[model samples]
Target: MSIEQRDQLVYVDNGAGDEPLSTREMNPLFSSVLEARLARRQVLKGSAGAAALGFFGLGLAGCNSDSDNDDAGDAPAADLLGFSAVAVSTADEIVVPEGYSYQVIIPWGTPILGSFPSFSVNNTGNDQAEQVGSHHDGMHFYPINDSSEDGLLVLNHEYVEPRLMHASAQGVSLSSGATPPLVGGLRPADEVRKEMNAHGVSVVRIVKGANNQWSVQPDSMNRRITALTPMEIHGPVRGSDFVKTLYSPNGTMTRGTLNNCGNGYTPWGTYMAAEENWAGYFTNKGDNPREHSRYGVPSGTGRWAWELADNGADEYIRFDASIKAADATGDYRNEPVCFGWMVEIDPFDPSSNPKKRTSMGRFGHEGVVFAPAEEGKPVVCYSGDDSRFEYIYKFVTAANYNAATANGSMLDEGILYVAKFNDDGTGEWMPLVYGENGLIEANGFTSQADVLVNTRLAADFMGATPMDRPEWGAVDPANGDVYFTLTNNTRRNDSNLNEANPRAANNHGHIIRWKEDGEQAATTFTWDIFLFAGDAGESGVENNKGSDPNGNDLTAENILSSPDGLWIDPDSRVWIQMDSGWDDPFGNCAMLVADPTTGDLKRFLVGPIDQEITGITMTPDQKTLFINVQHPGEGTSGDQFAGGSYSSTWPDNTPSTRPPRSATVVVWKNDGGVVGS
Candidate 1:
């Protein structure tokens, strides 16, 4: 089918709680994940608790549904179904399809170190390292070898949910025995401490079974790296005053990687996990009136106001911009300078300290895509900004490869560039080096430090094109074409639409593609809109123009709206994951597989109510699939609580007095063969 013709066959289901683009900023559904974490880590540099307070329970009516198709119930399970689908959206249960089973080998607060005792949900002996942390996000499975029996699972702990992760959920009240009120914002210090330690990555070993199953090996190399963990800094920007702090004492050392999201692994055998939205964790008191003006901290909002929590813990104090010291030497006025770079972890050795590769040029990095490895060639990477109207970026490591040196720290030296997409279907990679490219040009930028600390502003100054809401990205090994999820952008309405993001009220998002010239990731490339998303009925509409894939013209066989997670399987099959299906009549999120070579996309699996389909990975043998179910029943409250009142009593629902928890799941076929083969 032609690309345009294929687009006509698909449709985006918009049902309940589907708000306008502007309304999404305050959408309470999953805002806590963004507001509670991003504001404190990405935008602010201290006291995430206080910064998140300003956004407390700004409920925008959460919940969504998908459209129903008569064929949905009887449709043949896509060839991928030999492998069962597992649900990890809730903590109380781990659900897998019939014939296939799963167990919680590792759960939040599951003690890792022998020094600490097993976890008790009541927070009795929750040792941060020994116990599994909260809200698992992106993850990877490094199979041992072609015939090896086991591998390592390196997972990213995105953030903590105070209510579920700690003994007493913070920012919650006991009175009325109802859901916590949004008014008295800011979680307590203990809650913040638990969250801080929960922000890094975890590495655990897994073994296969005779029945084609997997389980965690407790003494099998399980380890945790928390917020307090010390790490090394590398690349041109390493140890530059931009990273030094009272905590590091050596400008070169930094503590932990926060808000780690989707990840990348090197052909040379290292793990690259991007630290995203990590700027909001610090507190810069609005005291400097001057500093506040420059960084865009709202004056009356009392930026980082929670830094004043009782006893004023040091961890909490770091977020405070109101430094008592007169100079940078004594006070942490410059604390916000430490985060937002891609952190490299050596999953093989638990003793290895993670390294922050600064050449990646800090931003709200959604994902980093590494080009296939080649000797004597530059390492190329593509990244995106999650915020609306933000920019997309790329990086080219200066150090050339030598297959012999493949795993020998490829990130040590590299150059970072921001993408500039042109209206004429072409684009260039603009180098963002220190003292170069008018980077020092003001918007309050005094030096390179300012440029890195405030990367979004830097990209803006460089004239980078703002994308629709770039999320996870994937590079096709078969064709070298890059595919990124723009998700949905409501702001691209009549007043703001452009060739790159050419749609208004874009509920369903499209995928953009670019093929590098002469096989060089550093070279200028040609670009085009790969697909448009909307209901079949909305074809030919303005915002939907150039989007309908099967319209007997240009936009055929395109995808529907709200494209969130994306991954390109080794076979060149493009897997698409969704999150905003609540508005659909179908009543859930879904997973779809697309053939970029043919522009043929088909729905593979759909999730249960109120859950986002995220984090898809495959075992090295390509025989197993692992997926993550995040916030399945996000809106459940005490008043609405019941056996089924919960958005979903997922996995295997049973009688349990436990709050819903997010988790990771493994799925494999009943027979030991290539999955989806």
Candidate 2:
């Protein structure tokens, strides 16, 4: 595509122009960053003679800690960055340092397009194609250059869990207040359509105010890409016969992306969204030998038997694979081949058709982490397979890095490899290339298309090392070492443990790191377990590293469980997030800040009751922290939802009081001072 054409696709300038959706607006931090940058550029443009003077850069800003004004004795101040911790136990309040405060910028479903009316409780509408998706998940705030007054916030809506998202609240029979069984694995047709429309991502513009806050840009630059959105296929696998279905004959197009989890923004500035847990959305006959053998759908294991639903909508009925059609080439029994890959989105332009770059090698992609792209060097990425006993993967693009092409187009060509951890604390990057690694030569494999279609089998054939439920991964900008969270695996134990995964029944979970050999993407790397989290006292001295001097072991002070969200700040400070397992003794989920080099980890903030600390992002200044509180009180049902019966009364405890909604909160220190100092 030409640069102008690409720019139009990424910049999103037409359609509704600009207008704020709500009469009442709150200043958001996200928009402030953009405004500040814009003002700086405006000054330079308006006064070139004065602005052409020598540049004077500012020194490092630090997070300051609050100290008491005592004449006696006080502790020394720590040298943290421009960040502080503030506790927000409720939604109606934005608690921060004495000077800093936050406001609700975007909640669920405020109309993005003109067709959909404002969202209402239990309101059913067919204008889903033009609506903001339900349930916001992972997101990023991109300041358009360092000058534009506005920027885009690319957000992912992971999935729409029925009861919490739909009109009928998961199809419960109101008379008896009973939920129908989630059996035969079939969902109602309308429910399926709603879900399909709500599964993808949204790119909306945001602006800032002089007071340093952000707000959403109403109708301008607002676009929603749903499961029904027409998308193109790119890479070697595009146009392959395996992905063909009744919907797309050439296999060059597909509908909506599902289960988009954590994401990565290219150095060139576009968004890379990974599709996860999408396989279970399709249906196939449990008895068809040819179908079962071809895709390995495990007989009777189809989760969404949509073909059998009572609804006559073809979109809802497509998931079924049980019926035998005279022409195998025309029906959707083979639809499973189309999903589970990384989809790229350009936030600047809303009209661009998102592309699922197939050469990245599809699997249960939790997230894709890119190494800083360098000229003439391989563009590398690290990804995890989010299943128990699954493997970790890496992809090195074939193209040389060109700073000009950083605009999210570099992902088109790549050599995908799977990891194999050895018993000697070392690992190898086994190539899963079409004709190499015995993948094509192995049993039950026919062509390169087959290998990509069933990537798990290809990895298994290459002897890829199995890992404990690997979730999200982060590449250390300072050291190029990759860190991934192995959430927990009940089936693993001492006897079944191996070099890469050493623990069994790993309840508390651990973070694993590996360095590519000589910092080369194609070579193998050294590996080790960074830390083991568990109930400090019960976990034993061996896992704890050293005794706490007091001799007492199992203490809450030393305990942490199921480490989930993880981020490495610019300065290399590691922030760890924990998701309290269902059986966790910890009362709430929390985010911990730690110095891995020194093994000095401290609890920073805890989440509300019954929620997981998932999405976490910080500003370039590191002055504020934006965190997501997902699925609070998930166990409660609509029929039993009420004031006291509800699991959590977060953000809001009044109004209908049906249930708690997942929300994102910004926390910072008061006094306009740096936090953690």
Candidate 3:
């Protein structure tokens, strides 16, 4: 497709644009299992149904409790969601519960490092490298000496919108997420650099002061790891021949991280940034290998056309992986293989190089959630591939986690497994090892490095159950139950329906929770549907899907769709954030709180027009909460943008002048109580 034609497809109803769908034809579908389970549910509705529900741990009351705790005869904890739920809104500002207030901090282009250059559309690429990046997604707050009032705030910058970011595109009539007109068939080098600088992670020191206000505090630890930052490659795929490129001939290093969507922190006090939707950053017109083809690398041009920079520098030209020589080392054919892995960064150590842990496997990694570490057990974590019909994954370290010596190296040697959900409310984790389960040399997987490089193909071959777009994952600290958000999937039809994913043409998504049979590293588990997202007006088996195991449905107090960002607090309250298109009965994307024990849910906060509510974290005391507002004026048309009109101008609220910016919002209660309460 021509560059102009591609630009026209950039802005969709959904802000981020749809992820490339999985094209594996032979993978097993979870729909049949779901159909069988639903049939069984219809036939057995009395005590037999109750017994079946208990077998799957589907009892709504106290289902998240441990088996030992259930037998202890302990009383249930008091309700934690005490605040009145907010109403749905389309206002160009934040709306929270009645007892709470919020402050906007560390917006895009806000300087947090050297020279402290102020924010401006005309800021140079160098200035962008020193300032906060754009479109904040997943985040984590690291406490300083375990203090609730002081800490390091680290977040991911998913991607950039050129029309809103560059001053040169002010009157160029560009839609949201569309690039400006090409200059002499090439993009301006500085514009490309600035966009690249805006697509990574940021670490800033924030302090809570009097009046419960939060502000950025410049410290030595404050840093910006952008697309131009240098990083190291570790694990089995480090020095493989598939990753040898002109930039890193030794295949042990790569430059920059892209499309950092979801994030996680390790037990050893380091941050991990997930590389999601990164395949579109490169164009591979020649020699399309399975690694690039399975990930949907464009054959014509990249999403942003960084490879067509006017200066034709090595860094920019390398984005076009058209083979230029006989071997991979002499060209950039292997450049696209370097991305799509979780990058580990130490927020406290400013000079440390971020390491990409290859043992975790590579795909459209929405995020990684690590289970609480045990003394003499392996460190276990779960991740979901955020693509239609993709599979969820788990990684168990080969070495047991030792608090005294735990570090990123533990991620270097691990077993990566894919999930398979069955019709009997049970699931298993199948190993994606190179030589196991038909992943041998005859089947095209030559080594462990090859399996890691083509993780999606390996998972498909293992007969893993395909799911809707799985986004964020959360683990309940009190009961060790794992929850995953299956964001909306409009492509699902009757042919692909399953027990876990029962809805066809699922516009609004659902959340699924599972409990491991024994430990976090165990392969077998029991699964159940926690909640289904929808509007109050929609009902029946196909539209909104049925309610949870407990009869919960759409109410004024609880309506949501596309559950993307998720977290479980110490009090066992499930926090859900939405990222969906504009729709009725649900005015805009929002955040909600749910009591898993009782299946009671309520809306907590609603965001501005055309914005996504994502990336949540909190202080050590749980009295303060932090969430992100991304792409506030996302769906504005080209004419609207050129006429100095936008859908939203949030955090600034100026009169049709300042473009809306993605920013972090800090929320606290008026009575100094817990945030949700």
Pick the TM-score winner.
Answer: 3
**Tens digits of per-residue lDDT for model 1, 1-677:** 01121122111111012111110122111111323234433432221211211222221111011122345775443443233333222233433444544343455565665565655545532266666666566777877764335888787776554444544533343211121222355446554555666667778777877666666676646778777788887765566665556676557777777767777777677777777655444444446433232233322212223344445666566666555775555656655555667788888887888887766766666667777877888777788876567667887776887877675356656666777776545688777655777775554667655566566666766677778878888887756778788877664555545555655667667777676766656558766555555544435454443232222222122234577788888877777777664343223566666654444555555555555667777877776777776655555543444322454555435315455555667665456565444
TM-score of 2: 0.79
Better of 1 and 2 by TM-score: 2
RMSD of each: 12.5, 15.3, 3.4
Model 2: lDDT of residue 463 = 71
User: What tens digits encode model 3's per-residue C-alpha lDDT throughout 164-230?
Assistant: 8788888777866578888898999999999999989999999999898888998999999998899
**TM-score computed on alpha carbons, candidate 3:** 0.94
TM-score of each predicted structure versus truth: 0.78, 0.79, 0.94
Q: Residue 462: error of model 2 in Å?
A: 1.3
Better of 1 and 3 by TM-score: 3
What local lDDT does model 2 show for residue 271?
81
Q: Distance (Å) between predicted and true CA of 199, model 2?
A: 1.6
